[model samples]
Target: MNQSMFIVWRESVEALLVIGILQAWISQQSQSHRLSKFLWSGVLLGLLLSGLLALLIMFAGDAMSGALNEWFQAGMALIASLLMVQMVGWMHRHGRSLKQDLQRHADQHLARRGGLGLMLLALLAVSREGSETVVFLYGAGARLRGPELGLFAVGGLLGLVLSALTIVLLHSSRRFISWRRFFALSEAVLLMLGAALLVSASERIGGQLLAMNLPEWVYGSVGDALWDSSHWLNDSHGIGGFLAGFAGYRATPSALTLAVWLGYWLLIAGWLRQRREEPLPCLG
Candidate 1:
């Protein structure tokens, strides 16, 4: 429920940011009255498309029940992790140019394609975030059941409400809160959540591989019990469970899982390092 809430809040906040920027730009125009109609239409259409995607995910999950579902789930987890990584990176890359880019897009559509183009722009922006939210929620909550699922839905609703409030604050007065700091915190949390998904994916794969009766060496090397910290910190209950849910904190991790976990962080760090060293492209 916590992860679901966070995912919804983060994704909704991002969508709101884009919509807010476009709406604000439109408001500044001399003839924005008609454009407002297009903008609202686009947002509604985007939301409709997003609802379609959610239904698709639901139906697909319902269709697959056994091994196929496991594989599908594993794939979704990996995809979610990759998406989270890319999302944070994308925000960083476009953060500086986002406002300018949005305005330019609005100008292009308004001049060339009129209302339809602007509508399309808004549609794509909102739909992208909306679809991402669906996938993230699905990936995070695939294993949950019963009343927990109810709480998951509740969390999402709360997140939406919170994001609405947040957008208002950002648009009006953000003196008490810094957007940069907020995103920095988000990036950190996302990385941890992404790692958790990766770990879950690894477990799925390992379970399948074990079932296949593969070479003993592979299991010995990868599946060998690394340590037993369950006594000190049980991953199935209490604080350990929360960490496990948030950051893939396994109390008794196998060697392979540990390697995969460590490797994920190292690779992400290297990517960030390389990205920092690369020269920025000239937008002029």
Candidate 2:
């Protein structure tokens, strides 16, 4: 429930922020009412598309069972992890430019293609985030049952409502939230969550490989348990649990998982540091 909630919140907040920017820009221009209608239409269409995608995920999950199901799940988990990285990185790099980019897009599309272009742009933007949310939550929701699943849905709904309220408040005040800080905090959380998903996916894939009669040696190397640090850093309880849910914390990781985790951090962190240290262009 918590996992789904956070991802939903983060994704929804991002989408809302985009819409808010569009609305704000439209308000400042001529033909503002036309632009508003186009934007709202885009949001409505996006929500319907999201619902359809969610249904597709449900049907697909139900269609596969047993080994095929495991493989499918493993694949989804891997995809989810990769998507998380892409989302966080994209947001970090483009967040500051989001408003400007959206405004430019609105201007160009509004001038060239009119309302239809605006609708298409909004649909594409919202659907991208919406579809991602569907895939991610579907994969995560599969691990829960009964009341847990219900709670997860509740969490997602609350996240959407809260995000909408936030957008409304920010719009009314005409004050942009600090996109940099918002994205930074969310990116950190996502990085950790991606780690957890990666570990889970790796373990699942290792299992599938074994089931397919892969050499025991391959599985052994990939699945060999490393040190158990659950005693000191239990991912299932307290703060460790929070970290586990937000970022993947493994009490016992395979050799491959450990190496991959370390390598991923080193590469991403190094690049981030370099980017941060680079001198900014002096404005004349």
Candidate 3:
């Protein structure tokens, strides 16, 4: 449930940011109301795309039912995790410029295609996020069900509505949430979620490799339990469970899981530290 909530919250927040950027730009333009219509159209079309992607993934998963399917699923999980990490990194590096880029694109479209160009710009922007959300949610949902899934969906809906209201408030009164601060806060949480997904992917792959008749020592090395934290704080209840869902906390994680998780954080943290130390771009 926690995992689902975080996934929805993080993803919904991102989607809202995109919409907010477009909406803000439109407000400054000569034809602001047209922008709203284009925005809604893009949103509806993107949703349709998301639904189709979800169906395709389900059909594909159903087709692969044995060891091969497990391997495929594991591979997909790793891909999704890596994509998430890349996404968060990109957002950190470019979040400030994102609005400018969108506005520039919108202007270019207006010059070349008039009103139709606005629709295209909105469609492309929303559809990219929509497709990604569908894929990531499908992969994550595979790990949860029943009450947990319900909670996750609810959390996502809440995030979506809250974000939308925030935009409305900010636009109307200029007295609501500051997006820069919000992104800064959410970025760390999103990164942690990415790490959890990576760990889960690695473990799933290890299990598949073992079942495929790989040598006992090889699989054993990958699966060897590093430590058990279930006694101290179980992962199915309270704070531990939330951490487990959001950050891939395992009671008895394998040596590989521990190694990969540690390595990922070290690399990301070091890169960010380096970026911080670097001089700002010269304006001359």
Candidate 4:
């Protein structure tokens, strides 16, 4: 539930950020009211696009059965994990210039195509964020059902509310929490969620592999638990369960799971380091 909440919160915040940028630009235009209508229309269309995607995913999942279903879910989880990493990296590189870039594009669009171009711009931006949110939520909550699914839905709704409040707070006062700090903190959490999704994918794949006639060592590495920690912190309940869902915690992890978890963090660390060391572009 927390995973769903966070996913929705983060994605909603990003979508809102894009809309706010476009709206702010439009507010300063000569035909502000005219453009505002197009902008809002675009936003509505983008949301409809995202809703269609969600329905497609749900129907596709329901259509599949047995191993194929597992494979599909695993693939979705893997894709979501990769996208999360990519989003963080892209934001790390482009966040400082995002507002300027949006306004510049808005200017060009309005110049070339008037309100139509502005509408298209807003549509693409909102759809990108909304589509991502749908995929991420599906990956995170694919297995949820009954009460759990209800909670997940509630979490998403609460997240949406929180995001609105968050934007208001940020716009109202930077003294409390700046955008930079918010992004930095959220990036870390996103990476952790990515790890969780990656682990989930690996586990699903491992289950499929285990069912096959694999070599003995392969089974040992993928299926055999190295040690038991459930006595201390059972991953199936309470705080540990939340950690398992949010951060990929394991009470009795197999070698394959451990290897994947470690490799993910190592890659993330190296990527972040390289990004940090890259020289900033020189201004004229």
| Candidate with the greatest lDDT versus the true structure | 4
Residue-level lDDT tens digits of model 2 in 8-99: 88899878877877887878888889778988999899989998988887788789998888888877888888898888767656666677
Clashing pairs in 1: none
Question: Which pairs, if any, clash in model 4?
Answer: none
Cα deviation at 276, candidate 1, in Å, is 4.7
- Give the TM-score of each candidate: 0.93, 0.87, 0.87, 0.96
Please state the error at residue 94 of candidate 3 in Å: 1.9
TM-score of 4: 0.96
Position 96, candidate 3: lDDT: 62
Candidate 1 residue-wise lDDT, 43-146, digit = tens: 99999999999899889988998788888888888899999999988877876577789899999999999999999999999999999998888888888899
Tens-place lDDT per residue, model 4, 44-133, is: 999999999999999999999999999999999999999999999788777888898889999999999999999999999989999999
Error of 2 at 47 (Å): 1.4
Candidate 2 least-lDDT 10 residues? 275-284
Q: What residue runs in model 1 are displaced by over 4 Å at the alpha carbon?
A: 221-224, 275-284
lDDT per residue as tens, model 3, 1-284: 45555566667656776777778778888888976898778777877877788788888888988776777677677777777777766776667677777779888988898777777777777777777776667656666679878877886677667656655664566355456655666667767777877887887788776766677778776878878889998878888877876787878888788888899899988977877754332111
Q: Quantify all predictions' global Cα lDDT against the true fold.
A: 0.86, 0.77, 0.73, 0.91
* Predicted structure 2, TM vs. truth: 0.87
